[model samples]
Target: MKLSEGVEAAIHCAALLAGLAPGKTLPAAALADYHGVSASYLVKHLNRLVAAGMLASVPGPHGGYRLGRPATRISLLDIVLAVEGPEPAFRCGEIRQRGPGALEPEAYRKPCGINVAMLRAEQAWRGALRAARLADVIAGYEAEADPRALAFGCAFLERHQRPGSPLSNPE
Candidate 1:
């Protein structure tokens, strides 16, 4: 199934945050800039993440966004759900019972084979995503990333990160 652009953005954004120093935060604009997405549009998805309890918004001049919990506790499915909601990607409209060659009402009582297969596919997809946490994504990224590039990214984040923010100092 094709996921929305927002789901991609949210996953990337969460991965970025997962790589940050504990309690450090990145503004939505910075995240958008890093990913080459529209900041305004990305903010809508960011808000969804916040509402999902996956991320927290810090309010103030130095305020931005930070993970609400450990990256290991936040799965790819969490990010997907935050941006796409809990609806299954493949919706069954019961078209088998609506066409000119409609099946009998008794047939409608049971889900069609196509619908069952789609549902199983969706379940498998969700299971895969649920097994993948943001930390796992970041770990894979770090494993394959160039040392110089990783250093450069760390430097860039440090340079852009806000100082003295409460988020930067966990209680």
Candidate 2:
């Protein structure tokens, strides 16, 4: 099923935050720059994450964002829900109730077969996402990513990650 771009951004942001040193955070603009997205567009999704307790926001200069909880405790499903919401991907319109042979409400007492099947599929999909922890995503990337690409990300983090202490933040 197709999910919104916000899901991708939220997941990526969480993954990137997974790499942050404790007491460090990344500004929304810096995150947008890393992913080649508009800062404004990315902030809304980031705000959703913050609201969901998946990401924590720190205000003021030298304040940005970091994971609200450990990567090990945050699932891909958490990020997906934070951005895409809890609605099922396939919302059955119950077209079976609309056709020529449509039966009375009492006659069609059972759940629609198509709706049941779609609901089962959605449950499976959500279960899979729930099984995927953000820490595991980081481990997989670190283990399998190209060294050159990894180096670029490492360098970018070094450049943009803001330390929590004002003394550590560059003017």
Candidate 3:
């Protein structure tokens, strides 16, 4: 199943936040700029992440966003659920009972095999996402990123980061 564009944005933003030093936050504008996305649109997805408890919002001049928990503790599935909700991707419509040759209601008392198989596939997809964590994505990225580039990124983020701000140090 194809995920919405917002899901892709949320995942990338989460990973970027995961790379920040503890207590450091990146403003939504910066996140939008970094990804070349619309700030307002991105904020909608960010809010979803906030509501899901995957990310926390810090309000104020120095306020932006930060992970609500450790990267390792947040799964891809958590982000997916946050952006997409918990509805199963494959919704079974009981198509087996809709046509002219449809089986009698009593004849098909059990769940349709097609429906069951689809549900199983959806479960497997969810399981794969659940097995992945933000930290895993970051680790893989850092492994492949050039050392100079990585250092530059850390420096850039640090320069833009607001420290000791009231919102930055959330209670």
Which of the numbered candidates is closest to the native, going by highest TM-score? 2
The 10-residue segment with the lowest total lDDT in model 1: 162-171
lDDT of each: 0.83, 0.88, 0.86
Question: What's the alpha carbon RMSD for model 2?
Answer: 3.6
Backbone clash pairs for candidate 3 read: none
Say which prediction, candidate 1 or candidate 3, comes out ahead on TM-score: 1
Better of 1 and 2 by lDDT: 2
What's each prediction's clash count?
Answer: 0, 0, 0
146: Cα error in model 3, Å: 4.1
Q: Candidate 2's residue-wise lDDT over 1-171, tens digit each?
A: 899998998999889977778788899999999999999999999999999988888887878988888898899999999898899999988778888998887887889898899999999999999999999999999999999989999889989998864333211
Worst 10 residues of 3 by lDDT: 162-171
Give each model a TM-score: 0.91, 0.93, 0.89
In candidate 3, stretches whose alpha carbon ends up further than 4 angstroms from where it belongs are 146-152, 164-171
What C-alpha lDDT does candidate 3 achieve relative to the native structure? 0.86
Cα RMSD, model 3: 2.3
lDDT of 3 by residue, 1-28 (tens): 7899999999999988876776778898
TM-score of 2: 0.93
